[model samples]
Target: SNHQSWVDTSIVQYISRDRLPLTRFFTKFELIYIPIVGQTFYFLDFPMMRRHSKQAVTKNPALAGKDIIEAKRACALLKDKPFTLLNYLEGTRFTPKKRNTQQSPYTHLLKPRAGGLALAINALGDEIDGILDMTIVYPDGVPTYGELWQGKIKRLGVDVRHIEIPDELFASLQDGGYENDSATKEQMFAWVEHLWRQKDERITSMLAEFEE
Candidate 1:
């Protein structure tokens, strides 16, 4: 998803029903200390990373690489079951102002943060079956999360493509793994970029239909 709104999750979940299991999302470790909801996510076993601010990491260099360890440990729980993991690769909700400032190549997306996904895949590549690449769109315009619950949202769209894991991707987790290996990481990023390009076109094509 380009992440225009929080409503995307429920919309996608409705459309994808039965095609996948209930999804567990990755959360920031800080959220785990929040009131009820955060604890619920912890109980539900959502992977949580204690993300470091750049300034914080700069102040304490040892904090680097800690997220990788947490993600790896969390993924261990998924090894014995068929689980759906949801990641918002865009990392944040999109706004035209933000997109322009970023000078993103795709017309409708933020540049994906590849590291979180890469680390998860590398750590649990063996336990995973395949990846589902899904694109979510709102034709009229982005809606606020409130608009969704109020039944004010109009047309919504979803497209899905599945990708199989290549054996070589996780061939050696012991030797620094996917995150540490420059070549493999780049390969994954190339794949993500290719998908984003297609998603840009797909949204364009879809919107054109509404225009017609």
Candidate 2:
């Protein structure tokens, strides 16, 4: 999904809770140490990833590929359970400042991150029913987490539909080629970028409907 704010979590649950299985998402490893909320997420089986910087991996070559291994391990844990795994492909909430900093080509989105989605597919592709593209729009302005709880947000739009993964690309991702092969990685990026462009246009259209 194209993330907008913290409120997106509740929105996703609101929209999917009944229709799907248990929902899980990836979280930063450090979150587990924060407080009650963090501990709760850990117990709920959220995948906690410790991402290493390129410089850190350069310093210790052994650190290379560890995150991918960890991600696959985390995903495999959910293989037997019926679950809806949500990856915010943009990797973070959208902000004007972030958009400019990223020099994003999309009018309403950041570039999609391919690795996380690839890892999920590699581990859980067969267990899941289908891939879904979810586009969320807050027709009122983007609200702060507190604003959402306070009932300040008046309008929202959410679209969720099945997306078919091309067979060749699906096979490549399922085989873990996305991590090891440059061509496969590029193919994944191109596919995700195409989706993001469509999502960006849909966001524009969703917002327009609010105006009318």
Candidate with the greatest TM-score versus the true structure = 2
Model 2: per-residue Cα lDDT over 26-136, one tens digit each: 888898889898999888888788888899999999998887778878877777678788889988899989999999998999888998889888877677679899999
Model 1, range 1-212, lDDT digits (tens) per residue? 55778787787678668988767777887897799979998887777766677798899999877767777888786666667888788889888888898998878888887766776675676576777877787788888888888998778777788866555654643234554677877776876787789888988887777777
Give the TM-score (vs. native) of candidate 1. Answer: 0.88
By summed lDDT, the worst window of 10 consecutive residues in model 2 runs over: 120-129
lDDT of each: 0.76, 0.87
Off by over 4 Å in 2: none
Among residues 3 or more apart in sequence or in different chains, the pairs in candidate 1 whose N, CA or C atoms overlap within 3 Å are none
Which candidate number has the best lDDT? 2
* Candidate 1, backbone clash total: 0
Compared to the true structure, candidate 2 yields what TM-score?
0.94
Q: Note the residue pairs that clash in candidate 2.
A: none
